[model samples]
Target chain A: MSTAVWNGAGRRIHIQEVGPRDGLQMEKAFVPTAQKIAMVNALSAAGLAKVEVTAFVSPTAIPALADAESVLRGIERRPGTVMTCLVPNVKGAQRAMGAGADELNLVMSVSETHNLCNLRMLRSQSFAGLQEVIAVAQQGQAAVNVSLSCSFGCPMEGDVPEQVVLDWSQRFIALGVQGITLCDTTGMAHPAQVHALVRAFKARWPQTPLTLHFHDTRAMALANVLAAIDAGADRFDASVGGLGGCPYAPGASGNACTEELVHALQLMGYDTGVDLAALTQVAAGLPAQIGHDIPSAIVKAGPVHQLHPAPASLEEIRSRAHERLQATANGL
Target chain B: MSTAVWNGAGRRIHIQEVGPRDGLQMEKAFVPTAQKIAMVNALSAAGLAKVEVTAFVSPTAIPALADAESVLRGIERRPGTVMTCLVPNVKGAQRAMGAGADELNLVMSVSETHNLCNLRMLRSQSFAGLQEVIAVAQQGQAAVNVSLSCSFGCPMEGDVPEQVVLDWSQRFIALGVQGITLCDTTGMAHPAQVHALVRAFKARWPQTPLTLHFHDTRAMALANVLAAIDAGADRFDASVGGLGGCPYAPGASGNACTEELVHALQLMGYDTGVDLAALTQVAAGLPAQIGHDIPSAIVKAGPVHQLHPAPASLEEIRSRAHERLQATANGL
Candidate 1:
């Protein structure tokens, strides 16, 4: 049984924690700035190389991230931890830069319908805004990453063509963007689509860094991630507890749960440098915080090899037997 | 934006629902035979091509399956549904035959350690038992299928070699086993492993039918399925609502959720002849039935393309906004 270790691309898989930004944004309750800060601090302590701290969109647009600055200001700065904030436009970019964000992520939906529905802007306008955001971030000396939302498939437009994503990606990279994250906003990406898109993107921009943000709404996120990884994508965006849904893209679930993703990568002998047990513990705390049970498989079932204590006594065994009986009785 | 219709072997992907046998045996609860019948009936209503109805195991060994005969007799058979049962030995095979099971499935753990721990018998003893079971089933004119458990990996002895699975498969086929299921007992198989194993298994056993039974313990179940499909293995075993865990393996989750698997296959343009929305409705009833939430991704979040009703009233929009605020306030 020889184990193969993946040490490609000068680094192992980079899991960018998106709980604070992508996760909290879709929830119904307002996470206090301090709690958001604490979540970020906890995620950083959990050995996440990059944390998407918050999005710097207007408060009216997304009230969940209204206190982005305070959250960024409150978290303890760990060396080598890259803190990022999402910027919808140049104005958001300026706000994130002023808040001392290490990285600025400018997002523009690849599909015209999604672009209009999500950002309330035309595709051309969003691209223009992205160009402006990239210029401003560069001027501020902050690393700029561009996310092509609905790059795989769109809820409104249905199937998004690869050439569209590729054309937009080249445009973004030409504007001095540092990285590209192909966002499966509505979870419409299948494995083949992910592989083809990532392979094409990588070939066109070999030097540019690529990340994949996948949702588990269709249970294809991990498969898509594998396809992306096989296509040379090293970085990915995931939520801690599979929190977050697309408000615009109806019925879409949360991003790929970070703990489960890490567990899969680690078991595959990919060096994620994430403590699976610790991440599982942190994920356990999320349901209470979110006021709802999370969609994460690892959080509810625990890790792949996690062992429950053997039935200590005959009574315990009998009780387990009884419970099993009830489960079977109920026809499950 | 082209969709590939999966017609590798036939028009539809054959789904063999294994919850009744593989799933129920792992639970501690002794589900009543009548309830097991109801669950099988439900699965049939959900359009499954086949269902593994029960396991005829010893009362002393797997107490949960003590009433296997009663369970097998109780199911309300549906048209075109093939009811199968697991038979561990010649005695079990005889019991299954007497119970009027449509098919008799012989399970042999591929790894010697697993074979011992699971069956308390050596590899040769298990093979001998399989031969006896096959002979008995053949004499009864019942179809015999062999499931090679721990074919991908084992708990006691990690990473069962590919050759071991191939050798066991060859032996089982030679013993007149008509069908084979390669099971990832411990969820330790990767896509590459699945691809290699399925390709090799098919190359050697071109005439023998192959089915893939996978567990999502490490979140690689679906990926492995896709790899196997790409490698030309069409038939798969899935549980409704992703119900079931290994009785012997600690911390193992259920089989690949049927709804999620069907959704993936359909989205990839593979005709599964399954209505995902209808399955989702059936899956929603399982949590209450099982007394715990199943680790199915699609059940909680719905499919990726399922659209939610947008807030129609200003008050509703305000309520959504307020909920988001509360989520943020709660520090989620």
Candidate 2:
């Protein structure tokens, strides 16, 4: 496989669907609780490794996900698919565990400025709060995954030192978080930067389940993903239909489209363990479901395996060309 | 330097701007001839290695480029830029050379179905006709480049064997063509296939200047480019503002956006020789000129280096947080 050429793993890539939470949280119109449940169920049934179900943050903070409890209660859990929920504080963490979330996804920005703007707290305070949340999760049945936003580059800080990310990750790992997701919150990640950071991260914590979350704000998401893979990172966080945009970067695009990544990886001979056809069918309906057009290339242009019929007039053009050649040959 | 991880060249990558020819050819509205000339001039000035100025096809066949001669005459010939024009036949080749074109980009499809549908001729006829065109170009000051469409995979016929593309390329090289372009005309290419084909082509014809032309129809163009580079292919064909689409595949996007590729490459530590800022300035104006928004990511969301300002309420939020911390410390 060409992936071998880049020094990436040939093993099956793990895909975690984050559309239900990361994606829908950015939607202006509230995706009804029923639709959110249905979306999560569909994604889980499609055999994703994990599906971030919803955020357990306060309704006043993220009104879009105000129905977090209703959605958690409504979903039918599928075996082998972990249902995770975003937890902003110990309160949200307890709420998520009470509602039976399989994993608690704790997020804090690696950039102090971004942490303040995004979480309304300093990085120190956010870390302290997440420590409490992790402590709470340790008392429960759910696993904990810490998502470090602005792990690549901060919109405000420009570049977050690699050591900063490592230190925060190390701190979280000390608390026994099961996973760490490095997020390009506003899509400032480039391929080289991703490869370097991922390599450094892996070298330090090889056994930790690391997920590389990318946004296609500048159209470098998939390329970054490829670079991350080459650096020995396999897990990815993608949203359906390329849902979710950055509130900070006005014109930036959303998370890397789930189907786009799966389609490309499958073609590159990487077993993504994804049913692309099933995923695309669900992705194709997202435009109407979200009341907007999507940025998913696979949904817009069918998979490469899906053949487009020869131009409708192929035979007609062939016959016409034959007649013209005949006339020219006859010297008419 | 992470491009080092991919075993690709650290040398400056060549950028060929094809928006004027391959891109404008698909537009429904007739972009005014003057605008076309200005766009070409701007692209040439932006340090592109080659600019596909226009096509010399029959006006009846491509009315959008009816003013090809005028555009060729009007564009300021930048000293370092090669002004290439698409030549479909012996007549077009003659016209392009006569109009001061620096290079003639001759084209045919490796896939017989695509050849028949697109050129209304069989692969044999295309090869024979291109041979004649090559003979004509040999008599002129212009260099000849053969662009093999569907070299990756045909939308109608599916996979075109890598051997077929190489065989055609070998034939063109035998005809003394200065360049050979492997075109993924409908964007069916994936990373593995591109890497394999490019490796084969480079190994077989080490000296020939091979350009990889990819459409973003399926959004794998950049990834394919990265793979090609890893396989020792350097030259790429990209359109500004992603200004073209496949007629056969509905909803398919255009050629890989030039600025997007340049931005990604620049960030990956490879020099593309083109000025991204200058190129993006011209690309930003394309939407107004074309009467539609484009898919160029850098143009839409400014380049990664173009930092967005921090949100306006940071200090206020910081002050509030500090005040709350003081209140809490005081046991209020």
Candidate 3:
């Protein structure tokens, strides 16, 4: 049987690293601003093209990122690295731009319940806020990416209609957002829905750069990514170590682990310019640092076909060899 | 958006538990026969409809499962549970039947290199052996399921053509095998390849039960499972705590972690009947037993939206809420 090499169009999957901002934000420990900067710098050294550095929300709102300005200034910027910040309104956008954020991410919840609970604003009010944030980012000459939260399915209002996502996408694109990230905020998406939505979105806005942010809450994140990729969407947002989830949504896991995502992409011969071994090294340290083991498969198990050292004793060697043979025989 | 409810028919996914035989066989520690039985019993208690117990191989060949009879005798079989054992040849089949295995799993490697290296036989010889096993198992009125290893791709040979998997499937099914499992032995399968193989196999033999076994070595196991499920596959093979890997296949992780599989399936609205919280309890003990952390996502992070207890003080509550609010705002 001849091997079929994955010759899919060699479009590099852009990984937007949300570790420092998305990962540390949820931690109980007050990761020092210096540690946050170090983590971001480490991510840059790890070859991540985009790193979400910090959030510019009010300190009273998020004490974890209270020193967002100092954190941003502390990062050792690498050439061609896009350092992004999450901004809620015009004030946050202005602050992010002033702190040297290369990109400003504007978010608006698609579901009214989520918008009210999350942003403390109604759907229409959040859109109004988005308009202001977009204006500020544009005036500051910084790229703005809009994330449509709960685009796939919402916990508060389940099964968000494709039409709603499409309508909001058009609005954001028309408002001059460079990219539109469709988020499965509550993990309510199936493959068919993902494929249909992505196909429809691409058909309507062919030129819009579409990014997918999926939570592994339902284990459909990677599957959804596959469907979307098949439907011609490439860029995706993943949190390293599968960190971060909606505090309000029950049973939602973090965004797809970046290592798992990278491993999947590289195996399919889709170059994402990520070093799996390096990523694993970075991830290995996370469990100890955060006081909980990370939810990543490859980091713990290592890569496939990885050979552990054979036992020195003859009996052990024979036993190990036999197990290998049985696994082979079992088609495992 | 309406709440996404699993529509029973297309949503019921079957998980084939391979922990007992595949998982324990690969471990360095010689799991006591009693422990193997207890583990199988625990797995059955956790609601697995099928559990692959032990292999009926020569003690000289696989000493780890040499106590197959003891393991089988010790297990407290639950009603409706399909207890399976791996059989290498006709001799193994006789032993399995005598030991009262509910099902006999016969394996043949599709790739000649793997067949020779692991089985010490040519592909035709392995097939001939399978025919004998099938004949014996049929005479005893025992069920036989054939797994074609390296069906998608091989570590030594690289690409495995689709026709090879199709041909093997046809041959195995014609031999009165009730099930066929495709093994991504080296974790080389891409989603497109998986979809193509499953579609072709399903088209040719729609009635034959199909199962997919994949390793996370390439990080495409779950993604491939999604593709296969989309292509009409309902049964999968998974290991508890993501234990077991093919020693012959360099760099492969263990079988897809049972916890991750169950989490994904349940979230997708496909009922596998396994209680995830119960499985997590089972998984929590695996790392200590194996001396390494199992490659399971849910085990580390717990379920999505798993809320940590809030602090008692109002000041602490306000601070935590603010942090969570900021994290959500950042789309972390």
Candidate 4:
């Protein structure tokens, strides 16, 4: 993760498909554990570098992901793919580690109001609990990623200070975690904010890998991605079919769509390792499984370069145009 | 426009709403002329500097916009707003001028195959007709903007050569037109292509104003906007509710949503001269007007910072969390 180890020019972009975890958790109707496993296996087979298969929050808290263990056990594990899970507490951390999670993604918000509302825990209590979880994760030899919710702005508190984020990031670094994800939990991150914050973070923590998780709620996620890239942040967490929105976060919508991100990056000549065509087919089947139409433009309309065939009168028009051009060429 | 004349830092962004014409043209259900005019006037009232009211194509060619003259005559033209109409031929130009259009947007395709499929004429024929139309527009004291279709790429012919676009742009410049629109007729534009093209065009002709018209066919319109801005293009053509698409262009979807563009620009601290809230309401009414759901994310998700009220149990969570924090702070 050091700048010396970092590839020159920030060309490598890693996509951690969070659809099975973050996306399915947004659905009111619980997706069957078997189907979730199938999707994880499909995503793994499709060359995704990482997949957050499920979250290990209390079932009483998020019933949609109640069968997280079952899904984790059912999926076929691939050789090169890292399987990750979100764990909110010591209990969840233990359970996720027992499920053989390659990485444990921990969470809290920089906004105290958001942290309390989202997890019903004081900021200090959440950090204390996370300390115990991190110890357990270390004992288990599992990598940990601390995801900071509302890192840019909060619904109740307006804007979260950059110092608070940088301070907490330092705390996570002290805890010997793998990396950090600055989550735009409610899609409040803007391009300028993203650029300045990401640049400062990279300059401050050049050795820590940064992942940007964006929601397309305000239609700035993709733009923010570009800004992040311009500012030297490359890793992103995208959900397939643009799945994942917070029901509690009113007017909230899904993540930066996986296919859209991939298509855009690929068009810009950035290699994502994930095949867009294969990812698109997987996205196309998501609506049926989730009982709602996805908010994906690429799924609705094929790739930007996918062409429509010419009309039936193409021959007649071409003949007429050729005749005119030929007649003009011959000076008729 | 010259860089010296542009606002400092290129902070000014122009949005030309093309919903009244391009949007309704794709709907199978014919909208009343009165309703069309009402929408146009409402858009102008919403502070949109320009609105493309309707297209004056032959009724047999495109019946959806057959009542173009009625719509043009019915609208209450605001002094600050430039009311525009699409004109494909000399006859269309005459009808548009007679109907009091402030600007006639002449159209042809840079790709010969696209021209053959769309206009059923040779490229030379279309240009010849456009020359006559331009003369008529000049006589009527109406400004003209020539929209070159498939300026990025074409479905029928694949990639349209950049030389062709630049060469055609030069021709339009020689024809005494006021401005030029590089249309992404099939959403075949990416951020890199957009940035490079807009930069090339601006460097070539710093005097003529350039407008980018993009479809969110692959969910890259806003990203393309960012690129065009980075490359020095300011004006763009957007559709309210993301309502327009080409029926002939397979996989084509709506233009960049007006509320989306305005919302993104406003968030990025750029002035778009359009009220996003007022525009969102107008866009909300478009699904009913078009007999289909609109493709706008802002219209569905609201503005980026429109915070939702906290849950009813927030008091419970606050008390419980504070109690836990106090107990832990006391080391009890």
TM-score, per-candidate, Cα-based: 0.79, 0.96, 0.73, 0.93
Candidate 1, CAPRI quality class derived from DockQ? incorrect
Clashing pairs in 4: none
Per-residue lDDT of model 4, residues B65-175, tens digit only: 999888899989787789999988788888898989999999999998899888888788889889999999999899999999999999767888788999999998998
For model 1, how does the per-residue alpha-carbon lDDT over B35-70 read when each residue is reduced to its tens digit? 777878878877887899888877888888788888
Best by lDDT: 2
Q: Which residue runs of candidate 4 sit more than 4 Å off their true CA positions?
A: A1-10, A248-252, A322-332, B1-10, B248-252, B330-332
Query: What's the DockQ for every one of the candidates?
Result: 0.17, 0.58, 0.15, 0.42
- Tens-digit lDDT track of model 2 for B52-130: 9999999999999999999999889888899999998889988888889999999899998898988898787788788
Tens-digit per-residue lDDT, A177-203, candidate 3:
898889887666666677678889988
- The numbered model that scores best in TM-score is 2
Q: Rank the candidates by TM-score, best first.
A: 2, 4, 1, 3
How does residue A4 of candidate 1 score in lDDT?
A: 21
Model 2 lDDT on a 0 to 1 scale:
0.87
Candidate 1 Cα deviation (angstroms), residue A298? 3.6
Q: Flag the better candidate by TM-score, 1 or 2.
A: 2
Better of 1 and 4 by lDDT: 4
